[model samples]
Target chain A: MSLDAVPVAETRRKGDVEPLVRLAGPDMAAVDALIVERMQSQVPVIPMLADHLVAAGGKRLRPLLTIAAARAAGASGPIEAPVRLAAAVEFIHTATLLHDDVVDSSDLRRGKVAAHLIWGAPSSVLVGDYLFARAFELMVETGRMRALGILATASSVISEGEVLQLTRAHDLNLDQATYLRIISAKTAELFAAAAEAGAVGVDADDATVAALRAYGLNLGLAFQLADDALDYGGQSEVLGKNAGDDFREGKVTLPLLLAAARTRGREDAFWDRTINKGERTEDDFRRARELIVGSGSVAATLDLAWDYADLARDALSALPASDWRAALERLADFAVSRVA
Target chain B: MSLDAVPVAETRRKGDVEPLVRLAGPDMAAVDALIVERMQSQVPVIPMLADHLVAAGGKRLRPLLTIAAARAAGASGPIEAPVRLAAAVEFIHTATLLHDDVVDSSDLRRGKVAAHLIWGAPSSVLVGDYLFARAFELMVETGRMRALGILATASSVISEGEVLQLTRAHDLNLDQATYLRIISAKTAELFAAAAEAGAVGVDADDATVAALRAYGLNLGLAFQLADDALDYGGQSEVLGKNAGDDFREGKVTLPLLLAAARTRGREDAFWDRTINKGERTEDDFRRARELIVGSGSVAATLDLAWDYADLARDALSALPASDWRAALERLADFAVSRVA
Candidate 1:
């Protein structure tokens, strides 16, 4: 299918997402099919709950990075292995969201009720495991040891990061170093593996694999930073979840962390009350947003995102010029531009 | 090492467990080490929570089956592949236990507090995922896609089984056929995979793999049947879980399903009130036990277990003669004898 065949209304306005779909358009459709095929089971709840979460509208960005990275790595044909791995990548992400909702006790996901709330935490948790197992099966079908190792390692890292985030949830003293470590393991690790697996799927050279991993890692960090900023400032439509979710949950993202850092004297008490102690009113979220913007942490967070996005773009220097490569660069810009 | 090298105290009265330990003694030690090594992580809760469950003394029957089956299939050497696979098998089992407890809302496991109760359900859910990922990584490191495929598929089947069990939980009308299907997927699938992976680890012939799978499938059926019986009749000290755990959970195991089938009139109402409606008085358990025994379901369940054990023993006819072979046969007897 050509870009010309795509309906004009369906075109993504986001700079990063557009190039991703445009370049990997045909392959992603196949990946989508594979994902749907593999997630089905004789057990009804597995499909019912899994499909509910899948339909909740995650952008499939991680898998897109996978397909695009593989194409850029010289497998330009309609190959099946990377497409399978891409499906696996999406499965892993969806599994995490399912488990995280149970962990955080969150009711909302992607503008819908969380799977745990709808089907019960047990179903969400088990189906998440099912998807994860399915992910490995797909990776194994890739018949690539490197891809398996990268994903398996990423799964462990993501879990570790989640546990770290759980432990450090409301600590007013959460340092930037700890926060970075948490995000690197929880978010960036899978992103890095997703892209690296794409290159490795085609047996790309070590240098290319390393470059893709770096690009994905930095892109993941940028993506997460932008997510943090959006949590405080963006609308529910843009956020895909309710705004001020992090505040109510007392999650200390960069904007909140930075804003707390900059606050002094009387302002420290407010941070302590709202975030540390979880004492909040309907008006408290407005006040928290005001302090977050007033202290310039939102801008600072976007700046940090921009810096990471730049790093992500620079890492792509090793890849040869291609539509896929350019799209990845644009993805870095779009990640930060969401906050803009 | 000879059998005399084993200490007198180490001899197991159970038909199967002794020879497994005696035959695979040295390699199992290595598998234990791998389990410990792979479970370690920088995030404290992962290792902390995982180790707590590992130390709680659930018999490592699943991993031992993998190692012993490998030995039976002619890999007698202290090869790292089977050992790693065995460790991976244990990790998968333990991870399921962690998640299953959360799903079942059970408070105790293996005479110790379940991980979900201790660390919270979310931690168990997430850490279970970490261990699962670690399991796949170990299988991949074996450089055997077949092994990875077997384990991964088993994981999905097991999750499917868990969901089925959840859906059918309070339905006293659940039949022998549906119950068999659930146990086969949830319990036997993993056991079968564990045995088959052992054979596949040595690149065993198709005939050999099929024989091993058959052996494992029958053994798992026998084992679960005995477990159901034990839940009704055995002591907590013997079962390693509380007696009447199924009764309290209202889980419709084989014994209960059979008893419910046999019961009529007022007895039917009793089961309906207890199992279906979740209304139980303290003395109702005592009366329920009497009804189950009087109904002869325990005897019938044990007979069914014996039949499966016979099938398991028969499946071993394909394997070459060895001590491991004899041990597997004895293990089959021990499975049925547990209920007897």
Candidate 2:
């Protein structure tokens, strides 16, 4: 499922076309350009700050979903709506990362000093607020009620998730249900919103809208699960962050949750030492990773992720076959594959 | 104006009579109840923490404006729209105050412990996020695009104004224009939004919207200016906090802006003693107050406040002459007279 194996299918094949790639190309371009233009307006400070983060570069997967969903729904001509919505999504994501660094009190982001460490906490907080404001303003300009509703709901959900995450942090007894809810609200909501916005823009039928939403939500959940797994086992160079960053921060990711469950009675001491203990060193993190891996939690979690990715692809089965739809399927494969 | 003089206003005035007061009674009741209801849902830790600060109530003036404006337009089927909007405004205000206390590193709010001081910094930050989320959810229930637009824009403006205010802090060179823009965006934008939401809900005409916007904007400006004057001159009992909190925080309020202009030769010494010098005591604040008063800056600022109040009343004059409109007129008078 990971991108390590999927050949970059060229020019859309007979049956297996890259629908998301085809549909999202212009949309991503629009979003990319808009992000640069809007972010550039913050003269002397905002632009530079924004650029430093943008240059660190995420996968741009969320914008891809937005554009692909729009195109899949028969949207054409200008399509400024999806682009703007995509940019707003990215802004919200970036703002949260900025504040998250402060909340986590981390020093590094994408192999560089986090904004808080570089510019200070006050600057980070204000800059995050600025980005949030900028995003809302962009959303308002779209003048779409459905779009506004989706984005606003996503935003509130994101905040709720963050608070939930914070509340559950360092509490090893936190259940899987709570963790899943956190990820759904914190992460999947945006992906779902991004995809749904496209259909909303073109005034797509309810079924199509629902289908795209399902695709995005499943894809997002799978994507986050893969991310959680990779943070435990993947390389820092590929991921743009240190391995076990979550473990170091005491976050209860999927692997840790599974590992905790596995260690319930047999390895209770190990759970207390690695999971409950806050004073984690390089060796402690390493051993914890080994414990999680040995418990088969990582592989089991990957299976769950693969299932979700499959479901994501299946959600698009009802749509008419198109080059853009093919790319969405590929993107789902890539979401899981990339993490694997 | 001080609520001490007007007391209860005897009996409730009918349609358009005593717009602010009539609006105040019901809106306050509704807002207070909603705030309490929302505050109750903060869960394990944040609820009591938020309540501690929420109970130290300031006048629910922003919510009053929202409900009053809607009622003044004669839409009384259900005050739900304005009530929700009012709650949204209050939530935003509370979130900003929480962040502001942290930013200022202050220990007091309305003669009680600040949220950060009482609940710790992390709790304050997370709780602020909680309130922000709650506000958005409330907006979603209202289902008005204009309301969404106004609330989102106002919240952004507040943040921008906060950033601007931060940069201008301790810098005596801040001009009247920047001062007005900061306070207007920070304070007036929400008030304007609250009023605008009222018109938006009832689908009032553009002229009515414009008039209400103008009234809100002018009133907000006058209120802030008078607030600044009170920080330097009003007694603690009436103001609800110690005088010169602004001075202690090294904020360049309107009175300070005026006083700085009048200082001429003593400018450097004055700023140096008051702003550049950190960790001010009561004696330092007292001397700064004396300097500001001796310069006639407070009086000039008060005159400016009256000017804005007059403009507010002028805007209200365009509305139909109802009792609510009359109450709005008194609210204009109240804006300036509250601190005097």
Most TM-score-accurate candidate:
1
Q: Tell me the whole-model lDDT of each prediction, alpha carbons only.
A: 0.85, 0.76
Per-residue lDDT of model 2, residues B159-266, tens digit only: 777767877757777778888998998888888888888777678888888899899999899889978888887777767666778988888898887777777687
lDDT of 2 at A154: 82
Q: What is the lDDT of residue A283 in candidate 1?
A: 92
Docking class of 1: medium
Regions of model 2 farther than 4 Å from truth: A1-23, A39-44, A264-270, A273-277, B1-19, B27-57, B76-80, B140-143, B234-242, B277-282
lDDT of 2 by residue, A170-259 (tens): 678888888889889888988999899878877889999999999999988988888888877887777677888999888888888898
A200-262 per-residue lDDT for model 1 (tens digits):
988899999999999999999999998888887887777777888889888999989998888
B240-288 per-residue lDDT for model 1 (tens digits) = 7788888998888888888888887658888989988999876887787
- Steric clash pairs (candidate 1): B16-B331
Give the clash count for each candidate: 1, 18
Model 1 residue B89 CA deviation (Å) reads 0.2
